[model samples]
Target chain A: MSLYYVQKFIYNINRDTKLQTGFAANADMILANYDLTDEEACALREADIGLLYVMGVNGQLLMHYAAYRGLAWDDYIQAMKDGLAKYGEVRAGSYVTIDGGAGGAV
Target chain B: MSLVFAGLCSHAPGITARAERAPAELREPFFANFNIMRQQLEAAKPDALIVIAAEHFANFFMDNMPAYAMGAAPYYEGPIEDPDWLKIKRRKIPGNANLSFRLIKTIMQDIDLAYSEEWKCDHGIMVPLHFLTPNYDIDIIPVNINCQTAPFTPLKRAWAFGKALRKACDFVDERIAIVATGGISHWPATPNSGKINEAWDRDFLDKFARNDKTALLAYNDEAVYADAGQGGAEIRTFIALAGAVEGRKINIAFYAPIPIYAVGCTIAMVDLDES
Candidate 1:
């Protein structure tokens, strides 16, 4: 919906060891609880940061998700930039890219 | 009244590990300012450091969020996970339990904040300590301001918190350095997160350098969030520090808009004369 499920999924997994262990064991099942779109679920399953960015996950949550995936900080940042290039526009959120540039819709 | 030294530092992970990713052009100014701050710290020779920084849900979470708290543990074992990708090494930081306990008692006289006898130091506290106090020899009093969690401490309240914190520091009999970490306009993780609000950053830095606490404290909550982003709310940490050192001259040693960490790396200080 509003990247809420995706954000929640990441937030929970980052904090809860049981959830992280479960997610590592069966990500799809662990992710099934959150009200996520197929695309959001797929992105989480694949650790697709670009798609997650397009889905409007807040950067704070996304940063940890990137770390959870073991993506280096620079690579995590690059994935977001690449998301803008691949996805055409930030679909929705507090920071939708305007004019395909760095400025966003606060 | 022995506040021998005080300064503001950026806890951006990049500031600590710039060599790994930041280009020479970007890294140059960042380190130059750090060197300046380091020299100042060396000159101050403070026996203890009171670091005011934000918690990234590292220790506290939604269910048990305290607006403000002090880590009273004898040693801050550092972060469980290094979000900086091992750019900075983890070290057990020495905690000043004696001074921390005294501040707890003294500051309570003015405001009812919280404290913890057990909590580890996250990057918000460690990053500055890593950069400014590499040896980890000085006794640290880590004061955590919940800048990340919502229903945050208000700007005015942060100022008042600083005022009371100053009183607490005065109660303790030791040369102490106060440090505030974070801010100047950049978000993390979002697509446009790395973009710098240079105008906002410069203006805020200028006001801080001029010791214009009135202008700083006057900023509405919405304006700050809109301009600095949520994490930038950590500016409250600086405001509280400002409360302690108001009316004194300030030196803005360095500032760099680092896209790698999505933060403007700023370092500033108010040199106090104990004479």
Candidate 2:
């Protein structure tokens, strides 16, 4: 799963503006350093919030990453919804889409 | 001097970021209560404020997470999330290294912990500070209970940490104030954001208000995850608040489900006895 490294990359990039600058320019270069599986690498490279979420990225890290990527709050929620529909469910980690996010969310 | 004030409040970033999105009826009243806590906190004239928060990877991360941590620094900076996104401007927050060191030394006597010279206050600390210490006049001492990572702090240990904190506050010369911030039940930052479990929240908060240590510590993580969602695990911060004021009843200033804010919004304070 390499979820730890995925979260670590997000954690580091979230705080380190210099790393973020590099990431903005060449995601492949940044993605290559982390030991991510092919799926993890693809999701991150595409800035695919939903897939990363489906891969079990903690929303704490994922939300910030989504914001850093210029996705607004509403967009961030929508991406996760799209992700739940596309990928089916959260694969790992603490976050999950309850009832396919069809209920309870305001 | 011992503790001059003690309180608990919510720290959802949305409280500031999405201020206009939530219904004014719920958001305004919740804010008024927070302002009430602030007025009361200022009246205590505390020398420093110790914030016990469940920081979301703002400072410590899973790479090497500590069960508990305290900040010992002359000054700290934060709202590590982009100022624009969080809607809380980034700034250098004041802190007291000397007071923090003294408190940490005593707290460590009872509980092992990591102390950091540098800390980035995420929504966890900044959101509370935004309401309670809007002026940033009081020196801050940030304390963190790891609520995000797994193998979380045991309920009993969290209570013990609170007891140790109370003892340390008593031992210090300054008129200290402690506030633990976290939600009782809700899913934050997920697809199911804005989901509110009012029944679960009231049941938990009731145990908290009474300082029912037995009932409070009885919560199992597995069950908490099932009923309260992963974010429910943040109860450790609230449980610690309960322990800090053990045997005393807390006056809840406010509690309601603000779905758009994404948690059972809460504000409360312990009525400390000063002789």
Candidate 3:
């Protein structure tokens, strides 16, 4: 498994009910007030975080493009997993570990 | 042999002349920056320019993608955007097929890289082209980097590739300017839209101005991502420029954080004549 890091995570507390109330809530429930940096924000925006969970490019690049276009973190994660499930496993590299918070598969 | 000058061009609405329709405050800074860039281009007077920019999802997608791609044909067409707002018309470019083919061959030989010749001009390229050559008749060699995908080229590798590109250009017989277009920081979409990392952007600017390739290459993907933002992947283009110059001091022309688009709009011109 290749590891990817999420630079930041932003949630629309109101508009994205599923994300804010779901993944954001889960993250806050566990990590509580995780002060994300601009880098983390960028990673989250690029959806590099999903790179940790998926393999090959279809899963990784698609998630990244979604994030770049401003998809919510929770939604992006779910979308990635769904895409992977349909597309199949990404080609494996060296098993890697990303040093970031706990995140769910898309 | 050809002389090559290389640097970065941030492709924002402002730089593309679309900013005239924006607020005065926004338009003012953009125009000011444009005037400065114009002077730099005049100083370079390149017969042709090799632009390195990222393609939006339009060209490459999840199904199939090449890590790097080059334009080898004699002409390219710009997207049909606001024709009135567009400052330039689609025109033929002077393409050095021999130089382009050679560069591709050398890059492949030196590294495990994949590229394509069948791609069209996107905003990443057209925005700068509009400014650098309003008529779009001047010749340009276009190279597209796959910044959108993973297994991304490390900053150091990108720089090394730029050096290889310079060597390839030397094998030709024309004057060329290289422009790397992209960003400092931007969160393209979301309610948290106007996010601008000025602090991180300044740090990059400082490092670039100092011509610190060692420091730049040393930066891991995380550090750059942290400092530059998700769009920060574009920083590779700048590093490539640094490699082409090879220790020359960068003559930064303009830098502005356009918060509306969540992008750090910047432009830097380097003097390659010294080499």
Tens-place lDDT digits, model 2, residues A1-106: 8998999999989887789899889989998999999988888878999999988989898988888888888889999988888888889988887765643444
Per-candidate chain B TM: 0.93, 0.98, 0.86
Reference-based lDDT, residue B104, model 3: 68
Which of candidates 1 and 3 is the stronger one according to DockQ? 1
Please give the ranking of all candidate structures by lDDT, highest first, separated by commas. 2, 1, 3
Docking class of 1: acceptable
Q: Order the numbered candidates by DockQ, best leading.
A: 2, 1, 3
Where is model 1 chain A poorest over a 10-residue stretch in terms of lDDT? Answer: A97-106
Ranking by TM-score: 2, 1, 3
Clashing pairs in 2: none
| Clash counts for all predictions | 2, 0, 12
lDDT of 2 by residue, B14-111 (tens): 89988888888888899999989999999999999999999989898877899999999999998878889989888889999999999989999999
Tell me how large the interface RMSD of candidate 2 is: 1.6
Q: Candidate 3's residue-wise lDDT over B1-275, tens digit each?
A: 56555677787533443354445776577667666675676576777778887765435554466666777665655532222333445444456666666666766665554555544554567777766666665677778777766668778788887787777667666676788887766543222233567888888888888889877787776765555545667778888778877778887776766664346677787776665
**Best by TM-score, which number?**
2
Off by over 4 Å in 2: none
TM-score of chain A, every prediction, order shown = 0.85, 0.91, 0.30
Best by DockQ: 2
Query: Per model, how much of the real contact set is kept?
Result: 0.29, 0.58, 0.00
TM-score of each: 0.83, 0.97, 0.66
Local error of candidate 3 at B262, Å?
2.7
